[model samples]
Target: MNFQKPKVKAPSYELIHKTKNIIDKYSVNTICIESACPNISECFSRNSATFLILGDICTRKCKFCNVKHGKPNIVDSSEPKRVANAINELGLKYVVITSVDRDDLSDYGVSQYVKVTKEIKKINKNIKIELLTPDFHAKKELMDKIINSNPYKLSHNIETVESLYKNIMPGCSYKRSLKVLEYYAKTGILTKSSIMVGLGEKKEELIKTFYDLFNCGVKQISIGQYLSPSFKHHLVIKYYNKKEFDELKEIALDIGFDSVQSGILVRSSYYADKM
Candidate 1:
């Protein structure tokens, strides 16, 4: 539980403050701030953020996640417009929209995603959207809603290897996550998923996971080191160095992923538009 922090440069307080002001002014939540992302300074400096919609409270208590787990607030009807407006104000040609797991909702928050994607497209036809969504419990109707929205890319993070799902992600199902990616892939829209390393998973296990995703028709993937958010969260079993990340990226590309982003600080939404 006492792992050393990575040797990254200090964040720019001025830029961080500006980013916080923009998020507050628009009354929006961003994963950048909420997750205490290591890339916050860089992403905020560039005026880019992954909007966290459908409230910050999550239904599932994943051991490695920083998102709060408990009963969530009532759905906010005005969130979509706020997201679109914030994206417009930031002049972002490419934006990422994500949300907490709203299992309380019948659609698992799919309607919110559809609305936000539609609003963003309506406001700026040329802007590209990448949605990092929850599994929707692999419901066909909910998945259909997301595909119908026609985001440039639809992504759901696998979070960790299959063998560790029960303990690390609890209520989540590894196979169901794959099915979600497969379903999205069948729609012909770009489909993506992400995973975290250093969770006591072996290299062979990681390779197998890559093959599983590639066979499921996932086009893009992100692999990153898993840093425990707090002492109460899952401990980091190990830290893969930069070279290891590079090797994993190569392995993933060979497995037929069209694009791969792998690094120590590469979260699912990190530099998402670059792909």
Candidate 2:
């Protein structure tokens, strides 16, 4: 069978230019840019982005991610300050912070996430901060540290259904990721999670996954189609259309999710303020 590349709509020139100017001027990095998210222009056009803290290089090579992998450079202590500065410059009322898995670090880069959140809050006490963090290998101390940071919302993407975890995420565990989200959900702050479809997940399995998250106390969710970063990465098994995504969203809402975003371009941080 021939592979049909999914169509990706072009981003607006004004949005690309404006987002580029901010990125260049502040020397800040966004997951939207680094991950090559399909919704970059939409998010950037709204003057919003998920800031990539800690650095661009990831320790884990998730098959779906475009971010570079390998030995990451030293953690730049100034990164938090710069990120805060960028948010201020953009005059953003809401901000999201996410980072690469720093498996080599003793704290698993948990402290950096906390520091960045603190610095951003310090800049403007009213700014709503959301964190999309790694699972921290499910380390108790690290999870506790993240909870202490008290971001407006806490999220850790399950990434894919449990059945596909082993094949797609070599170093991650579905159980551990759930525990991380469950832990944060128990904190009284809004807890969120995300999953990508079209990597060969079944409708029944996807419905079961939604129940698992709802049962774990997660209140917000994002569901989107998986676009393989490159041919070297995992192949997209299928591209779900709008109708299918809408059905998934309805299932999620019916499953007791307080808010849900499900569409081809929906991402963990896309239109996050609405959730």
Candidate 3:
């Protein structure tokens, strides 16, 4: 289709360096760096970040993800304290916590999520915490732990349309992801999910996916252009322009999404506090 890559503002080197310094000081990971998020500069400059807990290495090999995939390190028992300290040092009132899939662990890393959320709250009860998590195969026992932790919002990115699951998200089930969101939503917790466009998905397929999520009680959704991490990863089939993203947002809202963020750079945790 001969689509050109979208341009983003140049990152602020000073602020970015400052944010990195704090993160380095605490020895924690962030999806911003691990996933190569285009909005890292903006988020870091604002002194906000989506903390990547449970380590940087993932057990699953999702082709569209930039996070490292392989045997991960042993879970650090003291990570929760460090993460809480980092958030406090950043002076952030809202924090987003996500993790690499820890399928290697029997609990699929749910304990880390719970512990991190609790630790963040312990530091400051007023700080609002949001979690973007792996499916954990939708196990109620595991899901209950996160729910009981009382995060302000819960999110799990669907990532792509169901039809593209086989190629873009190996070992990940679209239905299972939906169930995870539904489980959280049913608890009256604000629930959200994200989708990447330009992965060779059709318009109708995208619409159907939106309806499926809304029906499952996902209240917030973000749609963005999928930039291939590298030539070896999934290829970007097309880039939706501003008009197309606007239309998608309108459609999702019409279908009852309480909030929608759609653009080339929009991501699951981008400007999450504002949402």
How are the candidates ranked when ordered by TM-score, highest leading? 3, 1, 2
Can you give the TM-score per candidate against the true fold? 0.96, 0.95, 0.97
lDDT value for model 1 = 0.89
Error of 1 at 3 (Å): 8.4
- All-Cα superposition RMSD per candidate: 1.8, 2.0, 1.1
Cα RMSD for predicted model 2: 2.0
The ten-residue window of minimal lDDT in model 2 covers 1-10
* Ten contiguous residues minimizing lDDT sum, candidate 1: 1-10
Query: Which residue pairs collide in model 2, if any?
Result: none
Residues 1-275, candidate 3: write the lDDT tens digits: 65666776777889889889999999999999999998888889899899999899999988889999999999999999999999998899999999999989999999999999888888999999999999999999999999999999999999999988987788899999999999999999999999999989999999999999999999999999998889989888898988999999999999999999999899999999999
User: What's the distance in Å from true for residue 57, model 1?
Assistant: 0.4
Please write out the lDDT profile of model 2 over residues 195-266, one tens digit for every residue. 999999999999989999998899999998898878998998988888888999999998889999998878
Q: What would the TM-score be for candidate 2 when compared with the true structure?
A: 0.95
Please provide the root mean square deviation of candidate 3 (C-alpha atoms, Å): 1.1
Give the higher-lDDT candidate: 2 or 3.
3
Candidate 1, pairs of clashing residues: none
Encode model 1's per-residue lDDT on 1-275: one tens digit a residue: 43455665666788768777878988999988778788888888878899999999889999988888899999999999998988888889999999999989988889999999998988999999998988899989889888988889888888889999989988899999999999999988898899999989999999999999999889999999998889999988999887888999999988889999999899898888887
